[model samples]
Target: MGEKQQRDRDLTRWGVSRRYSSLDMFYLFPIGEGLHTIEHKGRLFDLLIQNRGSDTTLVVFHGSLPPTQLTLPCLQGEGVSRLADVNLIALADPSLVMGDIDCAWFLGDRRIGPLRPILSPVIRYVLDSLNSKRTILFGGSGGGYAAVNFAQDFPGSIALAMNPRLNFNGTPSSKLPRYLEVCHGAMSRTPMLRVKRDFMTPNLLDDVNKQQDFDLLVVQNKNDKRYLHRQVNPFLSGVENPTRTWVSLFNGGDGHVPLPREEVAKLLKDLSNMESQTSDEYNSLGFESLGDYKQSVLSQDFS
Candidate 1:
């Protein structure tokens, strides 16, 4: 009823449903608050985690905005419940992360404020607990943006950003961007990648390369009416996306992060299978096929 109150129904609109695998979803914070000043703009934040396995953890960050009229439930992908062992975390205070996150970005630049480098330790702590090299990150819109930001600062992580906004500051104002500018104020201007000389070079993306390029997965539907699907082009202008990307653009659910249950199941299964495949079998997926052998070898590391 108020700004801080949260009422949970089915996080199904994001392509997930309660009917699936009954994987335990844990609310790490009733009123999720990430500490600020942990590193500059670093503040307390909320975490929505679905703890699953020791092998890999999937941290799901919501878009950066207050709320959305779209009302797409939290990413209700069947894979979440089915792969119960995979850890999932929605790292953000939805109301604070993105401007009043509707759909554009989940980890609101306005609220989260100029990408805190201080969050590095917390990320490392999570990795240590997971006992893995890089944890799988998930986000649609703003949350997707946050996933990229975090991965840039902390390497050894994979991100599945569904139609993510890869750049910040100097980008044209979109529906969500305009709203965040109006609400969160001077904070959103906090550059994720502060480059005094070339502000337009996607410094965040550049730094991401300096650390790890990420096993980046970009999923988007061509019919998306929110922003232009052309937004996806920025992801690859200077970066190397995953050698083997399993992109599904069919329009069934939300253009951002929605997919049918069966398809979701298949996608997850394939990803897991890819991770488990022997070196040769996994390479067949791609990379060497096009002389991108380096990436193929990287994928093999998962196995």
Candidate 2:
């Protein structure tokens, strides 16, 4: 249907090694990670790639966490403990981290101080390896922050963002920041964010300007309990990107993270439909309106 799907099947053929970071490891090694340089900023970004053959690259920015490899299974095992658990997981997941990771890896971290500058080397590495004219970026939560932030600073690439964390100025003053803050704190210099109101960017909803210059894709579950569809409404209210798709899956479940694959296939199919559209903004997610954003995607496609 599209390069993504074919690429997916091809990856299946190659199969995946164990979950180790190195392809050379004794495990299965379907994916590989390394350090690369983005000459523009003269900085190096940690790069992780899932081999799908071909050189078309997808640069995925992880959320507040270290990397998808470290985050997802952790989600499956310990499960999310914070209010933003769902947001962190779905926004940053297997696909963003592993999934159909083929081609060159253009992985980035949550490092602060102009993430683009810090990740310039990784970006350059992926671009240099590609024969295609376009490179796609996918991220959610903080990575969603990166998707938009990167698109804003580096406007040439395509971006797909899910329940992103673009609220740089909106975090609540809980006297302490959230746990995510502990990791990314070095960059922003703020402690962990307090829940809900403490850490999200203040004007995030109104800040999709960065999304304008490139091929952009957006995924959101109205039911996401963490970020709350209401929190992001202002951002998407007037978004004009035809390439953008707002999938209202698992409404109100966890405003932060996305539901498991058993619940997300419909949203995935929505992406598949894009293969035939010139540029689509599929608002197939069943939210009746923006305010009722938290209804269950499984329970209410009618919401």
Candidate 3:
């Protein structure tokens, strides 16, 4: 089968209907929005400019699907309405692999550097043009992995990685053959594999430890069988400055499920309202485990 046909079949299998072109899908954003597609290094990215501009911009890296699939719809239906004032840019992996455009967890693919040359200039231009003081990176799952990696590149940026798989090399505890297959494919396509060990989370923590300016928020379910051992535990333990990096563990869900749209919106809104923090102060928030968190929720005691 042809590439386009295969993509169509995949989308159909995923219960997604291609109602709009990749670029045209941005119209689903708020009315009177300036949305356009830009080509960088032969890859297409959607840029959405809010009518009433602000110095804050949210860069969204979608999970393992095409941009036109699940991510765009969620942003349009759930995120855009809640974050109408914030500038938004959505990026997708056209290759549909977990390399995430060279933003993988493992230190493989020497050709795939820390930052994509094509995207760096555009990102710099956007930040400069808006005089953006606060840049927030948001993503879930595979996209969350990308967010964490990219957050290091942009100084003083806040990153929210929901249920991120910290190590691509380790086998997922869950039974997800397709996800694993795609990830392996991405790794195989890379020209070189510099690091072979399964220490991606530790390496990431080490990298984050050097930078004392940014905040990394990792959200995961304590009951997540897929990455509790492989990703979350290692990340929480390895991070040098516990004060700067925080983990918010919830109850009653697998690693793959995303937080509710309302809750996510509220968090973004709160962050938007707050002044950017210069120091990385440790906030002892969230629960130690799902049991503790569940008890608090049941007791209606959030304090």
Q: Which regions in candidate 3 have their CA more than 4 angstroms from the true location?
A: 1-4, 8-33, 66-85, 97-115, 173-203, 210-212, 278-303
When 2 and 3 are scored with lDDT, the better candidate is 3
Candidate 3 TM-score, C-alpha based: 0.65
RMSD of each: 9.7, 12.8, 8.5
201, model 3: CA deviation in Å? 9.3
Give a tens-digit lDDT track for model 2, residues 168-278.
444422211332333233224433333223323335444454345555555666666445434344354445442433334445354465555443434433433344323
- Report the Cα lDDT for residue 236, model 2: 49
* Cα lDDT computed for each candidate against the true fold: 0.45, 0.39, 0.51
| TM, every model | 0.57, 0.49, 0.65
lDDT of 2 at 165: 52
Q: How high a TM-score does candidate 1 get? A: 0.57
Off by over 4 Å in 2: 1-44, 66-113, 153-156, 170-207, 238-248, 259-277, 280-303
Best candidate, TM-score-wise?
3
Clashing pairs in 3: none
